[model samples]
Target: MTWLILISASLNALLGLTLLLLWRIERRHAYVRMWGWSWILLSVGLTLGVALAEPGLVGLRYDLQALVASFSLMGSLSLQVAGARDYRGLPRGRGRGLPVFIAMMVVIVALAGIDQRFAVIAGASFLVVGAWLCAWWMGRGGDGGERFVALCFVAIGLVHASGPILDPFSRSPITHTLGLYVQMVLSLGLLLLSVRRAHAEARRQAERFEQLAHVSLQGLAVIQQHKLIYANPAAMTMFGLRDEAHVGRLDLQATIPPELQEEARERHRRVLADPAARIEWEGTRLTTDQRRLYVRSLSSHLPWDDAPAELLVMIDDSSRQKAVDALRRQALHDELTDLPNRNFAVERLRELTGHGAAPFALISADLDRFQLVNETLGHEVGDALLRAIARRLCRQLPPQAMLTRLGEDQFLVLIEETRDRAGAQAVAEQMMALLETPFAVGGTELYVHLSAGIALFPQDAADGPGLLRAADSAMHRAKGRAGAAYIFFDSAMNGATRTRLEIEQALGRAIAAREFLLEYQPKFAAGSRKLVGFEALVRWERPGLGRVPPVDFIPAAERTGQIKALGELILELAARQLRGWLQRFGRLLPVAVNVSPLQFEDAGFSARLLAGLQAQGLPHEAMEIEITETAAIGHLGRVLPQLAHLKSAGVHCALDDFGTGQSSLTMLRQLPIATVKLDRSMIDPLPEAQAAAVVSATCALGRSLGLQIVAEGVETETQARAAEALGCTQLQGYLLGRPLSAEAAGELLAGALSAV
Candidate 1:
């Protein structure tokens, strides 16, 4: 047991010496070095003092070792407490009082162990003070690793206080060996924690410096009074300053040329007063011995100490200002035409309207089917057309005519001091005629029509915004009428426009009022006279309005975005009727519904339709939808995808009014449609041989493309016979069946089924 105790104590003493050497190397890290040095001394002192007390070195030398051990423990404990508390703030002074207390306690303990008379009273005093310090740390809300350190302190105090009574226990070899091991391990753990914390703090400071350097865009330099102390890499290149020694002695004023010295000083003072504000200064710099630089520097001050400050400066060469000016010009003008854009147009209008003068007329013009021109000839040609139109209009305009391009296909012309209503009307006609002239774009002759709306100054509108609005409204009215004619803004036109807007708003509310109903038109097989399918047409039976024509309300609904909700409502009604028909007829005939162009634009249209069908528990194949060629061609790319998605989901797509569309048969073939319905006009004069040949040709084309051809608008047996001769397998019109209500259509199908 004695041998084991000696071996353990000796090993601990060696470790303590190594730690003391490491502490000397890292003395600059005060918290870590202090704790580490204290641990190393404690370990060595405890090992030697405990070993010597076992009765070999019997007197003052042994007492001195015990004294050294006590002082080391006290020093190490106090440092551990301070390092833990250092999270709040670093502690000051050497902490000499703790060491003094431990030294007096150690002397008293040595005397008590030697059986001195006053030893007991002195030991009691020392023990009370040590215990008070441990309790004091505990009372200050000690927990975590810090609480463990405090507990070790309390244990150490109790051990020393019980020294006289525990003479027998202290003499035991097992107790001394175990006690020495525990003390060495505790000191090493506490010292390692302190070292970790110091390293972490060093890393945090480095990170803060890195963040500051990253965030600053301007060149930064720290100067001490008149001399530069440090310059960041940006500062070095910005001012063309040399190395650190040059920066250390360089005066900032030396960088500015003599002529600009006063301006530089004024800007510098402003920066010093407000570090956040940018201060501009122009000065010449010497690029080399012979070359001189004319530089403009935007600078700000970053003060580090009260004695001196640093300046963060951004330098731009004056020669590059041309590029900056180009960017500013591009922002205000249209890039395609290099003309003053909509932003500039609005400003020009405001400036023109500011003057109180005679009548001036504002004319707003839009190119008819301009989108079609772009689609057919390409955007390059479209731009060339616009530029040519702008040049032609410029040539025709009087000196007072202010022409501004408003949008992609719209332009605004402000003519000041127009000759009353007749003169204003004549100017608008001339402008329209000039716009209609052929534009030679990329060697292609393009004919474009212009719709112009004239709003007279001080009468039609009193202000710029109002004048623009009136012109825009009148332009719509002009386009609504036939041909290339210009219309003056009038109150009657405004009333009609307001009525359309009111109708659009009313159509939105009609869907929720149960005013919408399904009117079904039955499809016959022509040969068997059996009902094959029913076309689902929507009718709005408003409470006071009675039955509204599909033409009037449908177009209005489509234009005003009431179409999507209306389409969904119609689909739900059709699906419900189909389900009921299937329940009664014992077999389901596909229901054909119509979809508007705007409805197809929604990305979620396919998913919503499929989910609605699934919710109704009806198979998707039981429904077929008709899309107009106008709608399909309006957004070909988006519509093609939407059609493909519907086809993939087992729904049928039919192109309605096939030949009436501008899209050729080749374009139609590219679409994934299962059927094509010949327009009503084709069947109107169907008995005529020329019309029959056209129908036959269409039917042959449909057959070649594997598309089912349904001939619509068959009015008589002669028309039906002609359609049959043309190989039309399905015929639907007033001849076979008119559009019927849900119940009437159901009864018609039932009667037809009975006949079959």
Candidate 2:
């Protein structure tokens, strides 16, 4: 037992010394770590007095053990005080009265040494109060280990304080020995507990280190003074490192390109000192003879250490980003010409307009008759021709210019920063010159032409799409001229296009507005000066626009897709006119109105037309539909069946503007037409070389096919004589009479018939 006493005393002294060193040398607190050490020493002093001596100093030992137990209780209180200082929620150093009580018990024990029940009673009371204070400290929830130790101390104090009071009643050495042994065990337990707590804390530190090594979106690494300490999985993969073995072999400088080393090092140094600093390593790629890595490294000094300390270097590969940029480029631009596609071009124009960068100008150009080349030669030749034209235009265009290939034959140019109209005009002239040269494909020469249009920003048009429309309108203006040419966008073009758009929109309300009116031109027989038929022509007498000629609004309606409604209205009006004429005159003379090719191609044209005629109670034979050569040739499949259905319904068909386009003697023989109207261009000259030959040939072709020929555009006597001499069966134009209003035309028709 004395040996046990010595062992306990020695261990206690060692623990106390250890705590003092950690508190003083390491500058750590004494409450949690050092306070536990104080309890170990106090427990040892109690055990030695009980276990040593011949009779084991029974009376002396009990009193001494009481004193040591009182001190041990104070250790837990000290722990609570230190914990409160650290956490701020627990009680501070406010247990001043407990120290006075400890002093009082020490004084009482000294005065009545052994065999003094009163002093023992006083010491035990002090120990109980001290233990209660320690328990209160633990109830505040300090560190887990310190709180557990405090709880054990409270229990030890309560049980052992009862021992001295009960020792006098039943003086058993074994009972006393049992109490000493319990002290021995608890001291040893606290020491073992302290060791285990230290081990656990070390393990937690390791786990945190591992977490930092792996926790980041970017690849993280630890590079000591530009040398690799560790490479995270992300960093290894980013730098193309196969494994840790690869990482162990290289440094940061070795992985980065030579040109980027100086900048990378400077950035790394800056980030290490200031945690907020972010450094971008510009070019971090490996060469053929070296390993390449793209890394944007951020370095920071850890809390525990400093020099060669640790760096949080991040590595990122930019090659995937480069590939993404390339893919984006390919998506928005044409592959062959490397020009912007329609979508990208429109988007760029919109962005420019949003910014209001400059006075932008848009030029739209379409290769005139480019489809003829594709149809006649081949698609490959056509493609070559387009590429050749594109290359030529690209070379001639200004360096700052942006060009877009809108379609097969259309090109759009955005003049972003043009100096003046002169600059735009100069660019247009350059384009024309480049395109004028003949393109040689398959060892054969082919010529190409372009009709160009210009639209200015904020003046002629407000935005990008509006500017494109303005340019398109200008191009149509150029197309109407004799030769293919370019024209600058003018306010006049805007006025005209706006007027046309208004008419097209108003066409829907024409029947409701009563603005739509029909006129008739008389058709006469060649030999007999007798009335044969009347040609009904549509004209719009708009309120403000005055008389909108059919030549102007009719073509605009067709282009704007409003002609379907317009054509239907014309037919309804003609049917109404025919009904009136037949009801009043008691004669069913046929009336012909020109139907556009687009109107004839409508699938429901027949049903709608027949329904209108039936509604007006007009005979089908008294109504005639005149179709142009272009309509008959373009949609021949849809037009022929529609014409046959009309003829089957007892209606007559006339081919208008014959011998002008693809019209010839062969097509005339196959068409369902009963009459052919010679084109104005074909009837302009006669009895004079070329004009006479054309008229004679057309007349002969018509006669051979058993079709009646109507000579059109005869304005003077000379033209009438030529048409008459050509054996034309019918003639129409100003020579006979101009197109008159419905009332006037009715009078004219009545007068002619009365004379006949």
Candidate 3:
């Protein structure tokens, strides 16, 4: 059927043009456009002979027949080039060599008019080469679809090539008919190849998405009908499973904690029923080993296994998230009392004020004489007392009130949801009663009183810090009164506070300006009144204020950290004086310098002190560190190590204000002190039977503990005699020699050179 050949050519040209228009619209594949052009060439070749019966074309009919064959041959070659360009990403222009091939084909077609058989053989060779190239190019792509495309090219090309080859040898109708069938096969093959490539591309995209899901940190899994269809490594690890099989084996509902499983099941049912529904649930997961782990899971719809599926994402929120919360708490809470610290209190206050909260009260409570507990009993006992106080305060506070430690012996109570000032007073009184009870600290029953200051919202200075300051000023006013009590903030309290702050500021400047000088109080042998070492007393001389009493600044300095720096200055000054004394007297006697507990806690205290002494050519044994009993007990543990270090370094240490502290015999025996400075209170009542008994017992204890007993604050002859009879070895007070300036002290030392 030559008509069939013509029809096939017409159909090929139509298909080519349709595909060309489709490619322009879709731009799906690079090979489609070239394949369309090839089909157009084949249609042109078939059409060449379809109208050959015209008289005008009768002389050129053989030439036209060869031209049709050449066109058909080149069309097949275009298909081969199209395959290469599509599969290998090669350019169609480079691969086809279209214009050169067309020129050569036209020349060959012209020569074919001389010998028709030669043209048939040449065209068949062209078909073979083109078909093989197409097969090879398509083979370079992915498997399955690519293999079929290659096979189609080979089969169609070989079939069409055989027609031209056999036609040259035989002039049979069967041989001519074979080309029509081959053309049909070619058209069908091209459509099949395109279809296969589309399927391959879809499969590749699915693979790429799967790979991306596999590497994700979130536990990703696909579930169809509550059975796992796929699981990534994270998903498997989250479920304590080995593979997809394990994921399917474990029932999700059963894996959740029993109490939470009901909600989880309901959520799952709702999500599965709707398919588009999304749900997030945070719950505990039960491991195979019966351990529970916290996890937050999110489930949403996804197309998996060719159906609507569930994409499950599990995030482990147990250890990591809880650790973050704990760190946040540590930042807010006090390490010792586990109470909210100053920062947390301020933040809470800001929150309350930001919301314009009303009628709340902030009470600043400072424990009165708390330092004595620390200094007498040691820091261990002091910390225990504070923690006990915190617990007690927290227990006693009203429901809406929050208690926070503002460091040291100070605490803040915020009545967040109070009604009026009466409600504030009720909270303050409740806290006061809590402190009224005796607390067992370091094996001793102790009573701590609170001096509380109250500042109300809107009534007092606005804002957190300002309100807290007003409360603090009121607290100071309360302290100035007879007993432990609470006072409301008033306008005049601010003036007192400002004055105190100014004094504190001035003290800071005085130390920096080296405006302090030391006065040495001579110590004597109790019985002989023989000269011994002198105690170094720090005296501050303000420019306009003259000499501010030690009573005014010493306590303030002790509360602030000015004591540490001031102690360093005093120690350095003392070391320099010792060097000068050593040169003057041909000997260096110990000059006792008072050390605050805060100063003793310095990590570099021992090293720095020794270095300063060494730099001044002063002997470490020529100076003694006098620490109050109250200060000593507060930092007992820290002091022990440093004290031992000082003893090893040939430095002297003594307990000052001896009997005032809670520690009596234990510290005397335990600490590496060379002397115990008996508090003036013990000797002030001297010569009385009771006072004598106390002094005798204290001195006996000191002697038994291998400690030197030096009675301080000896202001009378009777006190000195009592101290001597009470077994005191050294005496210090105004009775023997008042605290003297360096020049006066030098003169006294020179006068007492014979006695010394």
Candidate 4:
């Protein structure tokens, strides 16, 4: 029995030391520590039991030895139960079990002094109960190792129970040896349980990592020693790899573009040097199929299979980059014409005018009568026409020149290396000439005209915006000319534009303040010098500026669309003068009012004019409308109906400035006019052979058509007499009488009537 106890103690000590080493390795599992201490205490109890049975061993009293060994055994049993509870995650009894167990042990020890049998039974009972509790706790939710440990505990408990039954006073050699073997098996099972748990936890973590790598959207690759080792699904797809087999064979150098491979290698070296270093860059990558991919990549040092490796995370940024590029293009380009817009033009201008840039010409071209096309045709056709014009202009541009659509009906051309104003003017002329050929749009042959303005860099203005403004001003000046024209920017045009802007701003206030008046020029019958009628001319007398000439403000008013209001004011003034004359002399001469072509464009012009005459209670025959030949020819379709309407209502219509325009005899025959006024240019050179022949032909044509002929600007008697001989029905000029105010004209009319 003593040898068996010593052998069991040796085995228990060895197992305890092994468990303690494991606990030291993983301190978080405190149950291992507890189990180890329990085994050590059991070993101590067994050794003491041997000493108690052999009295000469330690030279202590039998009862004392027995009591000490019993206490050690009880403490070991308590620890075994506690360790089991902890391993199974069961709660401690909050220290109540400790005091009760201590009291029970004390009682058993006192009784053992009187009867050794009672101590034996009580100690054995304690061992059996504690072992059973451990078995229940460990086997409840335990794995194979823990269950095997619990079975060993049960076997050891039964052996201890048999020792008390068979030999109540002395230790039993057979049962003690059997309990020692079972305890050894239980210790081995505990160690195996710890190892199994660790292995299972490691497997679970690896599985989770694998799942994440497969599902990740970013391409993840591990490279070691310049060779691809591992790649996730995303990485395989990104590089056009077939599977893991393909990735294993792929070289890291092959994935990077040849030009960037050296840089990539340097970056990899840096990343490996510092484990915490993360390098990011944007570059092109080559796929398995030799396709290029734009990628934003991040490279970092990582550990793979216990070796240094590089982790490359590539995000496919190709789509995002393409979207960004497309958005940039849309921002700078016109969608309708697919041409660079004003924004791009401004950017190009800035680039061209930078510090070391060569001189360039900025040509601003505008389509003439574009609004007329938009109004007459549908906007669809207008858009097509603008696109066609843009194509033609683009074709005509020189290779060094860039064309950009500034806005509706306006294109800006930038010609590089332009030397002088003449070079710029040449480009402008070429661009304008392209529009002279008709464009076929929507099955309609459309005749488009262009007005171009050229401004030289560092000559007209220094910078981009200033150059554009100078060119635009020149373009407007060119637009004022008859047909397609190109002009160079001069400093004088800026002053003229400013003055025109000021005049346009003041026109509205001028009309509202009644700062205008009309003067009448008398027209006399050439045969008898009898008063025929008077032509009403509007004059402005600004308060502070005195009189502003009609030539200065009239075109400004028309351009600014203030002509309609000014025309209404003139009509009202004429009606009032006629009313006054009727009240004073009981009669009035027919007053001819010059109407603007813009006014004739209004569909309601005749309605508004006839309504005004009727509101004054004046007869329609008391007024006549005079339109210039240019107005009639330009807006022939629009003017014809309005003129016919007025003529049918007994209001006479006359074509003014006839010989100065390109109106043909056919156009004259088509007009609903009662008279044609020969312009001052035609009348000034009269009585010369060529001029006489021209005048004679005009008069003969007029007589054949049975239309009245009036010669204007008849400054000399010979010219007036020649006009009369050439069949002039009426004459009006400074030669007869200058323009007069309403009162003077009224007095003149009264005298003429009194004489008759």
TM-scores across all candidates? Answer: 0.47, 0.63, 0.55, 0.69
lDDT score, candidate 4: 0.86
For model 2, residues 1-756, the per-residue Cα lDDT tens digits are: 455445545655565555555446334333435454554545453453334323324455555665564455444334434542432334454576467646775665564465455554555555566555655655455567656656665765665566566664213354345445554454554555445655676788889867866675567677666667677876776767778887767755666667767866776677567655544444556632564444455556543345533455665546765676588888787776678888788888788777556787788988888898889888888888888888888877997677889878889888878747777787778888877779898568988888999887777777778888889998888777665699988888888988777777777677467678888888777766466888988878878768887887787778887787778878888888888887877776788988888887678898778888888888788888899897788888989888888878878899988877876567887788888898888888665778887778888878888888898888887887778888799878888878878888778778876775
> Which candidate leads in TM-score?
4
Q: Rank the candidates by lDDT, best first.
A: 4, 3, 1, 2
Task: Name the 10 consecutive residues with the lowest summed lDDT in model 1.
Answer: 84-93
Q: Which residue pairs overlap in candidate 4's backbone?
A: none
Mark the 10 consecutive residues where model 4 has the least summed lDDT.
51-60
Give residue 705's error in model 4 in angstroms.
Answer: 6.2
- Give lDDT for model 1: 0.71
lDDT of 1 by residue, 1-756 (tens): 455546655655555555556557656555455445545554554455444455434478756765665555455555445543443343533576566656776676776577543454454345445544643554356456656655655655555455445453234554454456555554565555456656776798879876775465556665444456777665665666666566776666667667877775666566667657666665566532324555665665675755435364555463565566577677667776666677776776777678676678888888888999789889988888889888888888777777778879888888877847877777778887786668788887888898889898878877788888889999998888776768889977777677677678789778888689998888777666668888898888878768877877888987877888899899989988888887798767788999987888799898899998888778898899899887788788788998899999999999988767784777658899998888888888878888888888888888898888888887898888888788777888888889998889888878866765
Runs in model 1 deviating more than 4 A are 1-362, 367-395, 399-409, 414-422, 433-449, 455-470, 477-492, 506-515, 527-530, 542-549, 552-562, 597-611, 633-650, 666-672, 704-706
Comparison by TM-score, 1 against 2, better one: 2
Q: Looking at candidate 3, what is the lDDT of residue 684?
A: 92
Q: On residues 1-756, what C-alpha lDDT tens digit does candidate 4 reach at each position?
A: 677778888899889889899889878677888889889888887787653365333234766777678777887887788878878878867577689679768978777766767777887788888898888888877777778888988887897789877776537787777877788888988888876766776788899988998999999888888888899999899989987888778866877877998998888888878889898899888888888788998899998888788998889888898898799999999989989999999988888888867888998989899998889888899999988877877887788788899998999999898878777777777776777789888788998888888899988888899999999999999999988998889999999888888899999999999899999999999978788899999999989788989998899899899998999899999999998898899888899999998998789999999999999989999999999998899998899999999999999999999888895878678998999999988889888889888888888888888888999999999999999999889999999989999989998999988887
Those runs of model 2 whose alpha carbons end farther than 4 Å from true positions after fitting are 1-218, 221-237, 240-327, 334-339, 350-399, 402-487, 495-515, 523-532, 541-548, 556-568, 598-621, 633-653, 662-678, 681-711, 714-731, 734-736
The Cα error of candidate 4 at residue 357, in Å, is: 9.2
lDDT computed for candidate 3: 0.78
If both were scored by lDDT, which would come out higher, candidate 2 or candidate 4? 4
Q: Count the backbone clashes (under 3 Å) in each candidate.
A: 0, 2, 9, 0
